[model samples]
Target: MEARLIPIALTIAGSDSGGGAGIQADLKAFSALGVYGASVITALTAQNTRAVTMVEPASCAMIAAQMQAVFDDLEIRAVKLGMLGDAQAIATVAAGLRGRDVPVVLDPVMVAKSGDRLLPTDALTALRTELLPLATVLTPNLPEAADLLDTAPACDEDRILEQGQALCELGAQAVLMKGGHGRGPECVDLLIRANGVTRLSAPRRATQNTHGTGCTLSAAIAAGLAQGMDLTQAVTRAHAYLQGAIAHADGLGVGSGHGPVHHFHGIWPNG
Candidate 1:
């Protein structure tokens, strides 16, 4: 009898030297979800929990070549996109993904965990015009949603649904507006599509190790999609997985700010 083969996922994002977010986190999530992961680094960042001290965007041609190299050699079923850094990078990625009929989970990563700008303000228009339409799903936190739509709505369930609708109008197939930053005891992530809206709520874990939550969640979802799960199931499983990662966070005191979640928590034995 032959053994089963897992699907493959590609993450086109930045490199985090801290190994908490960006491509590092995405690969962790993919591995945890039983998917083979490949990467096309858009930029390299000198970052830690506290802040991003430096960032270098890979040239548009180089970025595209890396992506081509992956697709040329592997059977990539899904793609997760993060920190594109600039309009050129965004356009380069969008063009590379245009004809590929793969599920794409776009984590509109505009700001870092330390509140530093990752995507340039001038690139937002290009993102909306070129990338959103091609995205299978767009996962944006409160601030990113507001920036994309140009309005900050109250963080209530009703307003979130409205904002999700507005984002859908911008041409995304589905919009997941995260409520982790919303003021509440429960972290509610809302998924809105032409079919309807579903709100997923989980009690907010009291931990500082949330550095890569958004990126991890999006990558997890992409992994699920690659494994043939439906949208709602993918979201549910990803959320549960992230909650567990947060609960088992490693108390790595690397910085005074947020730390990385324990990506290998349940899978590893403590020494």
Candidate 2:
């Protein structure tokens, strides 16, 4: 038999001990979407569904070594970046990825679901100057987008559209303004590229198990891109996948607080 080859997608992020978000979620989503997953963990958090108790960041040398190990061997088609803890980590990641032609989906993960600060205040400057320009698509929730633009969070559709455009003008190739934090019965994600803006809306499923939704969505988008899909097609498929996962979120009965969406929902029965 001929040797099998697979598309590889990379996730550079922190570790969620809870397994619902960060590197764990990214890996799971990558597998479920039929893409090979590689990871470079920037930080590790002692966290569960309720809160993050502690965080430990990796050294710049270690981070660079890991990225080099992967890049030297594997053909990484796309990358999803999340939870860069501080200025130094962000700078290291940016330097490692600066000239790569791979599609980078940057999830400006500043805060955790439990309301813990994942990215430091001083790091925002590095994120904007060093990282944002490297992204093929930037995914930011309302609060993150607001912080990135130094404006109040958008509460309505029009404001969110404006924010997306502003972010695109900040040098990111494209922007996906996530509306999960918006007040609505539907989740509206706006995709703004050079062509135009496309709104992806799905009925919001009521579930506390939405802890990893953002990470999963961005990872899935990267997976699609790795599979050679266009930006709009990848975003559309990612939105559908996320909606399905949210609708079938597992009630694993593991934690007392927010649970997690089933990454393998399509493969497993009754997720």
Best by lDDT: 2
Clashing pairs in 1: none
Residue ranges of candidate 2 with Cα displaced over 4 Å: none
What TM-score do all the candidates reach, one by one?
Answer: 0.96, 0.98
Model 2 per-residue lDDT tens digits across residues 91-188: 99999998888999999999999999998888999999998899999999999999999889999999999999999988899999999998768889
Tens digit per residue, CA lDDT, model 1, 12-80? 999999999999999999998899999999999999988999999899999989998999999999999
RMSD of each: 1.4, 1.0
Clash counts per candidate, in order, are 0, 0
lDDT value, residue 207 of candidate 2: 78
Candidate 2 to native Cα RMSD, angstroms: 1.0
